[model samples]
Target: MPKSLHRRLLEKGWSEDEIERTMQMMYSDEKREKHAHFVSATHPVIYWVGLVVAIVGNLLVAVTLIPFLMILNSTQLYVILGIVGFVFGSMFNLIIKDIEHVDQTHHIVAGVFIPAIALITVYIMVSVANRFNEVINNPNPHNAIVLSAVYLITFSAPYFVYKIKDFVWERKQKASEGA
Candidate 1:
């Protein structure tokens, strides 16, 4: 059986009258039924892959601190990461919404995955940057604070953007009351 709409309606607390009315309205138009098929829309692989790419590409903060030519100190490099984080966080917020297949689990998955990758990258970053550290004989510091910030700020960004989006949206249901 596909499913029983009547039973489903009863389970959902819809009164008999409401269920009948809703069923009548939904099935009344044969043209509308033809437009919506039962196969379900499946997206291409790349469409799904793009979400991964966007998350990975956006959270590449350690990359800024990894360049050989850019001779800024670790502190300066950390600042650069912050600047990049803001831009990337915003981009991530935008990209996740645009992607069709992404969900809360995807963000939650990234919550763990991005930081794990980030930790490894930061280790590499500190190692690479430490090569230029002649004045202060500092060993490899993982900068856990920065990494935790990466963990929190990166995935939480979309939610913050979503909240702000809510604040900015205006409903046009009613005309101007102030004449």
Candidate 2:
């Protein structure tokens, strides 16, 4: 496929800002929707409710899933949690995305907050439930925190990958404009 005009201009060292200005002048009558999130709703309240439900769902999943699986095998418990985290993370990511311009503030906050709370609750529940087990007979917050990190990483991995891609794209656009 042929390179876009913007790409051609950039390759020839035209500043991104100039191309954007020129494009705007050429297509001044066109209207553009600023938000890129895939959610169909236009109201902010719907997104807030989705975010809240996703958080609750994540917590419910983690709270029940971890200890139940921990019984089957203590060694790979964190691994199992991480896998589950990844699934929940992806689902929550979609739920968190919506039509409210962009979740700039919520992205960093809610994105992590949902999974983190779930994992933390899992840690607490596990420690409490395994009070009789020799390994966790003396349950420690430090160990739970460490184990929770495994879940946290996998859960947020999918979401963060998209966020990182956006970040890099933004930086590239900024650098192109600067040049």
Best by lDDT: 2
Candidate lDDT (C-alpha), each: 0.56, 0.69
Best by TM-score: 2
lDDT of 2 by residue, 95-151 (tens): 666522465675567766777677777677666556535566543222566667777
Model 2: lowest-lDDT 10 consecutive positions: 31-40
Candidate 1 per-residue lDDT over residues 56-160, each given as its tens digit: 674455555555214655466456665566665566556555442445665556445544555555555555555645335544434545644654465456657
For every candidate structure, what is the RMSD over all alpha carbons to the true structure, in angstroms? 13.2, 10.7
lDDT of 2: 0.69
| CA lDDT for candidate 1 | 0.56
Off by over 4 Å in 1: 1-47, 55-64, 68-70, 100-104, 110-112, 131-158, 163-179
lDDT of 2 at 179: 100
